[model samples]
Target: MRGLVESAEIVVADGMPLVWASRLARAPLPERVTGADLIWSLSELAASRGWPIYLLGGPPGVAARAAGQLVERHPELVVCGVDAPPYGFDACDGGREKVRRKVVEAGPRLVFVGLGFPRQDRLIAELRRELPDAWFVGCGAAIAFAAGTVRRAPAWMRRSGLEWAFRLVSEPGRLARRYLVHDLPFAAALLTSTLLHRLTTAGPPFQQPPS
Candidate 1:
């Protein structure tokens, strides 16, 4: 997880806790930047600049619906195409070739891969050669969020860093262990380490000169 994030071209605080931790370290970030928000932001940029974009990943019909939603909002946005491969498609060469063909045929300027986590990042890494000049974004579930297939947490919960709780409640069977067991401890450790680093790095205090 750390390696994947470190390798990313642009890494932002996707969760509110990260933003809060930054503040605790006295190095505040501009704001939390989630993958869902990036979809809208990038789409707006594409609309203005006449850049055609491709949507890849998400469940069947999801990428297509997300593309429609974006085009409806931004008339000038050019949606080259969408290709939502089957689950675990990344593990197979046939599936990879299919996605490569889509990108080759579309020739889009930007491609959003919303397959989630390491999977999306892995796919982007593998397909970089297919469209060397195009921008490939590992957007996780941004396409699903944009398509309205998955509901996001309430604004208050999101801002308060309880969005994970909300999502856990929404999908307990699927997310319980991930949120409570894995992510919570990792987040705590990360914040603690950040604070400790800040404290240890503080040098000697400045002394005032007297006449």
Candidate 2:
């Protein structure tokens, strides 16, 4: 995780909990920069600039559907390609290499990768070798959200920082342990520690006059 964070050119707070944690720590980042929002904004910029974009990842057919929708929304946008590799494809024979070749062939200025985590980030790193000028985004579930295969939390729930709860309810089988057992408590502890550290360091230290 540290390697991933260190390697990324930009690391934005994606969820409200992370946004809250930053505020509690007094760093006060501007906003929650969700992948879905980034997709929309980047697509708009691409449309205006006439830059082509590549879509890779999400469930089979999802990224392709998202690409169609993006073109529909931004008529001027250029979607060079879309692909959804099978599960564990990254580990299979020449799977990542094959995708790399496709992306290289497309010669897009931007690549939106929805494969999630280490795989998505790793793929971006590999692709960066050949597509040095291309910008890449690791978009987690955003492609599915764009394709409407999955629904995002409502604005109220998102702003309330209960999007995790909404997602747990929406996909309990998939997200129950992840939110209940892992993320929630972990975020709480992290927020508490950050707040405590901020309080401890808030004021200037007393300076005794020289003897």
Candidate 3:
């Protein structure tokens, strides 16, 4: 686990469930880190620290808007560049490498990758091996929210963990199947399986590595 984390450019705790799990596993986490919050915090920190930043992924123009908004909010922040990749993963050709080279040349201290889910995680893992100096962070849809391209749930809704409800209301057509039909069911199944395993097992439980 330490090897993977040491290999990572910047390891971020993404899912709330993961954060809670870390507590149960007795892992020492610095904080309950969310991608959206992390991006803004990093921007503010970079402003005073003078570390250049690069944003990659999201819908067309989303990255630009995010970079612009961040610069406006933190005038001292140096946003090195921004790039929005194709909608589909397979559609992207040299786009990834292009972004990589641009970031390397810009010599940014932080690079936020918003390709979403496993893709973003995988990319950062790869970059961790390839680019040792530049810190890579995987932020799902963070660029869009930072850009105000997508409206987040109200503070109350977020505190209640009902942010998914707000997203569903805002973009039903796009997220209906994802939240309702797929993820929810899969999450329930996993929870049930965990409970059953706990009931059947007698010894100390196994733990997942940080990676």
Candidate 4:
């Protein structure tokens, strides 16, 4: 199997189960790469390396607040900009186009997108042609965590693969189907597929190198 390749800089195993499974399979992975952690870690790295970042998504003031907090935490970090825009797939007409243009013009080294699932993933993928040099990642609600609106699960809970439960409890209505139905089944299927492929294949599983 492809194992998981990203056209961007790096793809961390954000989900707890994926992190543990990768360890079991002996796949070298960075520490559980939550978006918030990624932001902070990358911010520090970028500061030393002189890489700029852009934060896209979050509710109205959330992105701005998150950017503020990030800059505050890492005073040397260079944040190109922060914009929230709309949520649904069909962004406010030219909104997505405008964002794409901004990213290209800004020439940032990293672009953290928070539109959540398929939307953020698809948007970043689509923008690849325009923003070739930028490492665009779909960070789900990482921005909210940075904004202090949501709390991440404790280390133990995260390691136990019950971070979803913590989040479900925090925002039950928004995440009912996501945790209980959508992600759970999807994750199960992914695990089954990975294991089956590993057992059946002769060669070692491919690992994506840092971009």
**Best model per TM-score:** 2
lDDT of 3 by residue, 1-211 (tens): 3554566545666544444444444454555567888889989998898989999889889999999999998999999888786766434657667655666677678889998766776667766566677777878888999999899888787765577788899999999998899867765665566567666757665555777
Count of clashes in candidate 2: 0
* Model 4 ranges off by over 4 Å: 1-9, 23-31, 89-93, 188-211
Clashes of each: 0, 0, 0, 0
Q: What is the TM-score of each candidate against the true structure?
A: 0.89, 0.92, 0.77, 0.80
lDDT of 4 at 29: 67
lDDT of each structure? Answer: 0.85, 0.87, 0.76, 0.79
Give the per-residue lDDT digits (tens) of candidate 4, residues 168-193. Answer: 99999999998889889987887777
Top model number, lDDT: 2
C-alpha displacement of 40 in model 2, angstroms? 0.5
How much is the lDDT of residue 90 in candidate 3?
31
Error of 3 at 190 (Å): 3.9
Q: How close is candidate 4 to the true structure, as a TM-score?
A: 0.80
Q: Which is the better candidate, 1 or 2, if ranked by lDDT?
A: 2
Candidate 1 per-residue lDDT, tens place, 6-64, comes to 87678877887788787767767868988889999999998999999999988899999
User: Once model 2 is optimally superposed onto the true structure by TM-score, how far is the C-alpha of residue 39 displaced, in angstroms?
Assistant: 0.5
Best-to-worst TM-score order: 2, 1, 4, 3
